[model samples]
Target: MLVSLIFKRTYRPNVNTIQWNKTIQNHQSNGNYQQALKLFQLGIEKNTFQPNSVTYLTILDICKELKSLPTVRKIHHLIDESKNLNNDDIQNNPRIRSLLMDVYIKCQDIDSAYKIFQSMNERNLIDYCAIMTGFNHQKQYEKTFELSKQIPASIKYSSPVLCTLILQACIELNKYDDGYKIHQYGKKFLPNNKIFMNELLNFYLKFHQEKQALDIFDKYQNQQTIIDYSLLMKYYNRQYQPDKTIELCYRLKNHSHIQIDHIIYVLVLQAIANGCCLHTSEQIYNQIKKSQTHMDINNALINMYGKLGNLDQAEKIFNSMSKHNIVSYNILLNLYGLYYQSDKALKTYHQMCQHGHQPDDKTYVLLLHTLSQTPNKINDVKRIFSTIEEHKRGPMVTAAMIAALIRAQLFDEVNDLLKKLPKENILFYAMKANSNETNEKFHYPISITNEQLALYDLLMSNIYTYAGLHDRLTNVDEILYENKILKDRLSYSWFERSNGKIEYFKSEQLQLKTCEHTEKLALINALDEQKNSSSPILIGKNHRTCTECHDYFKKVSLSSSQKKVYLRDSTRFHIFSNGTCSCEISS
Candidate 1:
């Protein structure tokens, strides 16, 4: 019972360099970065063991994980002083160079990363991917695309992630053709890659290929993250389908699979603004306020309120913000214009300038619109018009200028101005784009009369209708039918109520009854089609309202208890009531 058995214990305190390195690797792998660093320092201090390639690689990983430039510099210094790095095997490793570049990039030292990348003798796929990623992070989109092209010919194609980065560059630069080609070239790699798919969706959306964007989203909705949903929502917003954006938000919420973020909330707020759904906007606002908010949300609230004609609320939001950027000022300025508060708009413009916010083309356009509405500011309008021309504003501004000139009834001056306008100006393009002639290279000075301007206004105002009709006119039978319809409708006719049914007259009937102008006949037909409303009837015409129709609408309005009729001829707006037209423009 008292037998004692002796067991030998293996107690060895000495550890070799390989054993220490293994321990450090295990520590780093187990997420004990501090312990790993401690062990590494102890080994170097002891001087009995030297750091090896494994030790250096692990240190690089630690530097990248920490994203600390100071720690990276220390590790790089050690690498420079270490004699173990003199080994051919350790000195010639391409992976080491690539990892160094990645670490520098992660720490925001892009120049250092580029230097390391350039110093490498034999660049590999990893090196190219890392540098391109750095360029993308820095937002050097053109450089990113350019670098992608210089990948070694030996590497026939880049990886999916690299290709996605290149496509993103293309998206930022709006290189549609190049993007499409890359999409085709990389089709084999796109099936399961979310990043690639997102950039592709962006490309399609920007080019107005909504159907294509929808198809891609539908194909990948199950695999989509929150970012994907936001992309799709933004696409819908661009297309003016706010209802669809709201529907998508609901769909995302109902699934409850993805966690919502502030960015998504901002986009949803924009959608609500577009929809003018006050109730939904309030609900979303409450939700965002519960969490941290972003500046974009505040800006979007201002935009939504402004769009809904809630100027007071928009102003309150704008005033409450701690800081305001150019966009905030622009939105406020635009809202003032929308509400026809020209004085306030000019004040806001001055405020914007005072705050060092340079006005953009859109700003000038909004100012021009307000000035066009206020005829008393003709002198100010002229100065602003000249400034806009000096700035070389687009076709829209040119159109607005034409409208203002015609509104002021300066027909002779308008003709002279049109004659003097440069051949390459937007005014020329607007004239050519709206012309009925089929010549591609048609020169401008394209007829400078009131009727010409009226034709321009009508074509511009009814752009969608004109486009549809243009397409339909390619068929001979359709053209004949449309002409017949136009011919039979009377210029002064109204729809008659018969047996609880609306009876519409044809152009031929109109021609037989009275020789009213075609434009007036269309208005009559429209007013007659909606006979129950007491509000003003608004109509647009390609030419001046003939005296006959002008007299007719005035008489009708007077007899019908002073109901108003608003008409826009190419020259000016005519509001006829009580046998009087507001314009007083006698043809």
Candidate 2:
């Protein structure tokens, strides 16, 4: 009878433990982590079963998913106590230790994770990866680099995951030399590993080592994923090489093995918009419309069409959306503003408000800009400005309001607003310089540091030119030249051909001195191309259209036998036809 009782006492616990582990694993596999955690807690409280390493590991995983730091610590303590109860020494088990480290990292307790790593009897690759990744996740890049140096020399080549993390650390530390060395090591030891290769490409790109980045990209072009292409295109776009961005888009489209995801589609559309390739934009749009729609893609299309001066297409896309987000409404409002349709913009704003989509800062700014263009809408501008929350009225909003009052010839009101602005405000100085009625001498504040002085000078020069104060403009220009702050903002334009080729022309490339301005050169090219094509001329300008170029475009439209010109400048689209432009005509 004694033997039978003892056997049952020992045997029943093992059976219960097996059942509990199976049940917990089943719940975890089904993604019922919370239920699994409850079962673990019940088992611990009931004390009916002894939890083996499997049970501890499973529960730890559950804690990780829940990000329950308390539960993890409890489990860790129980595991420690289990050394006496069940003879399960965690010191001998690397798996439990690694899992504990992972849980600690997931719970954002890197200190505890590192302690576990330090207590490990045998520090394998997995152990190193866990703690190093934790350090990286915590943004302890210096610690990550320090740990990498401690890696055992016996381990021949670093794992791809480890190498990637190290490269990321190098990037954060701005250790370009170390990153280059890793790239060389990866090429030799981790050859053809796409994960490591991609990291290598990113490291080079982040440092603006474009030549080396392109080398990797060209070599691994066949193996490049959508992410790699996206990164390259983004890098080129940031570098202001929109032409190269478009080229990459074409290459990505032609790659047979690659699938064009929504992200890539949005990026391609952005490049097309930046390059002002109307034909390419249409082709891409046709492809997009046939696929499953994404809101981002639709937003990009709306923005692209708006830039292309195709308002009808933009509106059509906006109306087709079953759901509207704040971005969608803002883009529509901006479109109306771009075409100088103040009434339509106001209507859209009302519709947006009715839809319960609150206007953001961008929406308010666009509304102010649109309303300020029409003389009759000054009251509407005032009403909208009054409704804006106090915190939202920053320099940009106040500047827009000031410009509106100036346009309305409300000089006294403008002066009042200007006085309220702090002297350190660059926009305040710009507005003061722009107003013809104000003869206030420009005062440079002591707080305006050297870095801001260049921007201030440039802003004043633009204001002087816009106000037709040529003497003031020339004076600012000399200041800019003396300080070596004036840069030749060379003008350029691009247009798409029927064959999907984008032809680019720079102001310096024009043979005739009269065609030195970007818009004139673009018009000359467009008229020459008009003989063979019936499509409207769409030119993308690199800078805002000056008044001289605006007048030139108007005169050209009057005499060009009804040739429509769509010039997308830095500020907005200027669609010229029949001697009329989409922009509000200045008095």
TM for candidate 1 is 0.53
The sequence of per-residue lDDT tens digits that candidate 1 reaches over residues 89-204 is 34566776678789999999988888888888888777777888888899988888887778764552557777778888888888888788878777767658777887888888
Give candidate 2 regions above 4 Å deviation: 1-19, 50-52, 76-88, 91-93, 108-123, 131-157, 189-191, 358-361, 375-466, 470-490, 497-499, 507-516, 585-587
TM-scores of the models, in the order given: 0.53, 0.78
TM-score of 2: 0.78
Tell me how candidate 2 scores on lDDT: 0.73
| Candidate 1 local Cα displacement, residue 455, angstroms | 18
lDDT of 2 by residue, 1-587 (tens): 22222223322245788899999999999999999988877766555676787888888888888998887887887666555444544436789989998999999999999998888878888778788888988899999888888887454146777778889999999999988877766676433677787788789998989999888888766688887888888877655566677778778879999988898888888788777777777777788878899999999889888878789989998989898899998888877766788888999999999999988767887788777777899999999999987666776567667767766778688777776666657667655554566755565442333224423433443444446652333322232233221222324667876667777766443222222466677777777876677678888775445667778888887887456788876556787877878665531
Q: Which ten residues in a row have the lowest lDDT in candidate 1?
A: 1-10
What's the C-alpha lDDT at position 113 in model 1? 89
Quote the lDDT for 491 in model 1. Answer: 23
Top-scoring candidate (TM-score) = 2
List the lowest-lDDT window of 10 residues for candidate 2. 479-488
